[model samples]
Target chain A: MKIPTLHIPDGFISAPVSLLFLVISGFFVFLALRGAKKQLDEKVAPLAGLAAVFIFAMQMINFPVAAGTSGHLIGGALAAILIGPWAGVLAVTVVLIVQALVFADGGLTAIGLNVFIMSVLATLGAWYLFRFFQKIFPKNRIGFLTATAIASYLSVPISALGFTFQFALGGTAAITLDKVLIAMVGVHSVIGIGEAIITVLTISAVLSVRKDLVFGASKLKVSLVR
Target chain B: MSTKRIVQIGLVLSLFVAAFVSFYASANPDGLEFVAEQVGFLDTAKDSATGSSPLADYGLTGFEDERLSVGIAGIIGVLLTAVISFGLFTLIKKR
Candidate 1:
C-alpha cells in the first residue's frame, strides 16, 4: 500500500498554474514576513516557534474521516487563535517549507500551492472570521471558544475551496470544475468538524492554564456594563 | 503561567505527539487524495523530486521497524521546525 502524502503533489497542477501560485505565494510571504516582524515581540516570538512545532507534529496524526479517507490538522485556525494572525502565517509557512524541503512531505514544485492555501488563505481567513464573530458574541471564554469553533470549522472548507479554484485553473485531469469543487468541499466540510473540535480543545487547554498566552482569548473580557 | 513554562509544555506536547501518538495515525488517504481519486485526478500526481530522501513519506530509510521509522522522523521534524522557526522569529523580532 502506498503511503499518503499531506500536500498537493506535483503534476496535479499545470506548470502555468503552479508558477502563478508561486508568484502569489511569494507576494504573501513578503507581506507575512513584514507583518510578523512588526507583531512579534521577544516574549511572543518563542511561542510562535512552538506553535509551528506543534502544528508540524499534529499534522502527522491523521484521524480517520469518512470511509477510506482520513484528515489531519491544517492548523491555521489553531495557530491564529494561539498566536496573532501574522505570526500564525509565519508559523504555518515554516512548517510547509520544512515539510517540503526536509521531509519531502509536500511536492517541491507544488510548495507554493500548499503554502498559499494552507498558510496564507487559511490563516488569514480564520483570523478575520474569528474576529468578525468575536464582535457579535459576548466578551467571555464561552464566546471566544464559540467563535473559534465556527472559524476553525469553516477554515478547512475555505482552504478546500482554494484548492478547487486552483484545480479549476490548472488541473491536469479531465475532470469538470463543478464536480471537483463539490467533492472537495463536501469531504472537507466533514473534516472541518474534526478541525474545529481539535482547535477548540487545544485553545481551551491553553486558556485553562495561561489565558494571556492565547491571542484570541486575551482580548475577551467579562462585560462590566451589563 | 510563565512564558518559559508555557514553552516547555508546548515542547513536551509536540515531542509526545510526534514521537509516540503519531504511530496510531490512520493509514487512509486524506481528504484531498480521496477527492482526487473520486474525481479521477489521482493519476495526475507525479513522484516528488525529493521522493528518494531518507525521510520521504515520513519514514527513516532502511529502518526495519515502521513505528521507529515514523516516530523518529516525526521527532526530527518537530525539532527541526522548532529550531528554524524559533531562529527566524527571534531574528525578525523587534529590538
Candidate 2:
C-alpha cells in the first residue's frame, strides 16, 4: 500500500491558482504575525511554541477512520484553544512550512493552497465557532470543552469545503466539483469526529493541569472572576 | 505544576509522540487523499519539488528499517518545529 500524503501534493492544482493562494497566504501570515504580537507575551510565548511542536508531532499519527482511510490532527481548534487564534494561525503555519520545506510532507508548490485551507481557514473557522458556542453555553469547563469539540468537528468539513472550492477553480483533473465536494465532505465528516475527540481530549488534559495557560478556558476564568 | 514544568512536560510528551508512538500510526490514505482517489483526481498528483530530499515522505535516507527512518524523521520534525516556532514567537513577543 502507498503511504498517504498529509496535505495537497504538487500538480494537483494549476500554477496560477496555486500562486494566488500563496499570495493570499502571505497576507494572512503577515496578519497573524501582527495579531500574535499582543498575545505572545513572555508567559505565553513558550507555550505557543510548544503548541506548534505538539501539533507537528500529533499530526504524524494518523488514526484510521474507516476502510482505507485515516485521519490525523489538523490542530487548528486545538491550537486556537491552547494559544489564541492569531498565534494558532502562526503556529500551524509554521508547522506547515516546516513540513513542506524540510520533510516534504506537503507540496512545495502547493504550500499556498495548503496553508490557506488548513491554517487560515481552519484556524479562523474554529476560533469563531468556538466563540459562538461559548456565547450560547454556560461559561464553564464543560461548556468550553463542548465548544472546542463542536468547533473542531465543524472545522474539518469547512476545510474540506475550502479544498473543494480550490479544486473547482484550478483542479488539474476533470472530476466534477459536485463529486469532489461530496466525497471530500463525506469522508472528512467522519475524520472531523476524530478531530473533535482529539481536540477535546488534549484541551481537557491541559485544562486539568493548568487552566491559566489554556486560552479558551482562561477566558471563562476571566468571566467568572468578573 | 508551574508553567515551566508544564511546558517541560509538554515538550517531553511531544518528543515521546514523535520518536516512539509515530511508528504505530495508521498507514491508510488520509481523508483528502482518499477523497481524491474516490473522486478520480488522484492521478493528477505530481511528485513534490523536494521529492528527492533525504527526509522526503517522513523517512530518512540510508536507513533500512522503516520504523527507525520514520521515527528519526519525526523527531527531527519536532525539534525543527519547536526551534523555529519558538524563535518566531519570541521575536514577535512583547518586551
lDDT of 1 at B52: 91
Off by over 4 Å in 2: A1-3, A220-226
TM-scores of chain A, one for each prediction: 0.95, 0.95
Global Cα RMSD, each model: 1.9, 1.8
- Candidate 2 lDDT score at position A163: 92
Per-candidate DockQ vs. reference: 0.78, 0.79
Instruction: Summarize candidate 1's per-residue lDDT along B2-72 as a digit string, tens digits.
Output: 88898899899999999889889998999999998988999999988888988899888998888899889
Question: Relative to the true structure, how large is the alpha-carbon lDDT of every model?
Answer: 0.88, 0.88
* Per-residue lDDT of candidate 1, residues A62-103 (tens digit): 999978899999999999888888889889999998888888
Chain B TM-score, candidates in order: 0.97, 0.96
